[model samples]
Target: MLWPDPAQRDRLVEIRDNLLARIAEAEREGWLGEVEGLQMSLAGAEEKLTQLDRRQSNRSVVDLGIPAPATRVVGAVRNKSVNSSAAHTPVSLP
Candidate 1:
């Protein structure tokens, strides 16, 4: 349920690179326990990067046009004021 912070992208990439380097060193020294722990951390960092990528992709803008009025105002008819009843009539949109 945690939202990804865009500001942490650079830090996460750095952490992933560091983890990869540590994993290589651990494997060379035959430190199986440390290698397993580093692998788990690396997985977490990579998952966060994936989340940021998804967030970036979904940052498009969409336009929702203005709302229409329930009843439109009609102009005066035959140089006389419009009837109150006619003025309050609901308009149907196409």
Candidate 2:
């Protein structure tokens, strides 16, 4: 899942801690390969948690009864002078 719910977040944290412990144990036992793999997995988990946190912080569900304000289009394509000329162009060419 791209963004997991609260329960999934809890599970991910639990799994991450377990993997970290395993990585430490592997390092103590001189199993460098296993430790490397577990470290990569832990990094992935941490990244996912960061992404989820960012998404949650940046999103909001607002309900405004009235419509939103109209947006003004600027730049070459939608400038007032260009828009006036563009409006006269025919859709289909003979």
Candidate 3:
């Protein structure tokens, strides 16, 4: 599975959340066109999320040395470090 880098993942999550909120507001304001646009964006955001998950399987472990260093992802790039929390947070969707 290919996982998105941390920054990309975070951006995707943010986009999804914003889209949801905007969609809700559009519906309330009776703006059908706006609602549709927001819905489409929401769908794209969701698709990208799925793609990210399909690409990355954190469950899969790779060994580089005797002691494996912790890894962090930055925009689909992987960086290894011992103490970094930024690499672990993935977008959790409902």
Candidate 4:
């Protein structure tokens, strides 16, 4: 497990428990729809947390000594005015 540290593991468990409690409370309050949404959100958060833990445990620095290519900007950019008339009109570029 990436979270070999006891403190980090405990924090993750605390967060999971808090989310579960919130779902339960929502259910008890008869907010079925809200509870469902909350459950989905909590599941996503848990999955991300697990992935992060794994990444932290297996992180390593490797220097390949390769230079990255320079980025180039292309194409003309135009800015449209918000809250303007919907009618099509020629916009002059400065």
What total of clashing residue pairs does each candidate reach? 0, 0, 7, 0
Give the alpha carbon lDDT tens digit for every residue of 1-94 in model 1. 7977999899999999999999999999999999999999999999999999999999998888888878866985565566857887998999
Listed in order, each prediction's TM-score against the native is 0.67, 0.60, 0.55, 0.45
Q: Residue 59 of model 4: what lDDT?
A: 84
The C-alpha local distance difference test score for the whole of candidate 3 amounts to 0.83
Give the CA lDDT, 0 to 100, for residue 17 in model 1: 100
Candidate 1 Cα outliers beyond 4 Å, as residue runs: 68-94
Candidate 4 TM-score, true structure as reference: 0.45
lDDT of each: 0.92, 0.84, 0.83, 0.77
lDDT string for model 2 (1-94, tens) is 5566645877788888999899989999999999899999999988877877787788998886898899998866744665786689788978
Error of 4 at 43 (Å): 1.1
- In candidate 2, stretches whose alpha carbon ends up further than 4 angstroms from where it belongs are 63-94
lDDT of 1: 0.92
Report the lDDT tens digits of candidate 4 across residue range 1-94.
3333544666667777888999999989999998998898789668767776777778899898989998787986777688556556677899
The candidate scoring highest on lDDT is 1
lDDT of 4: 0.77
Q: What is the lDDT of residue 22 in candidate 1?
A: 100
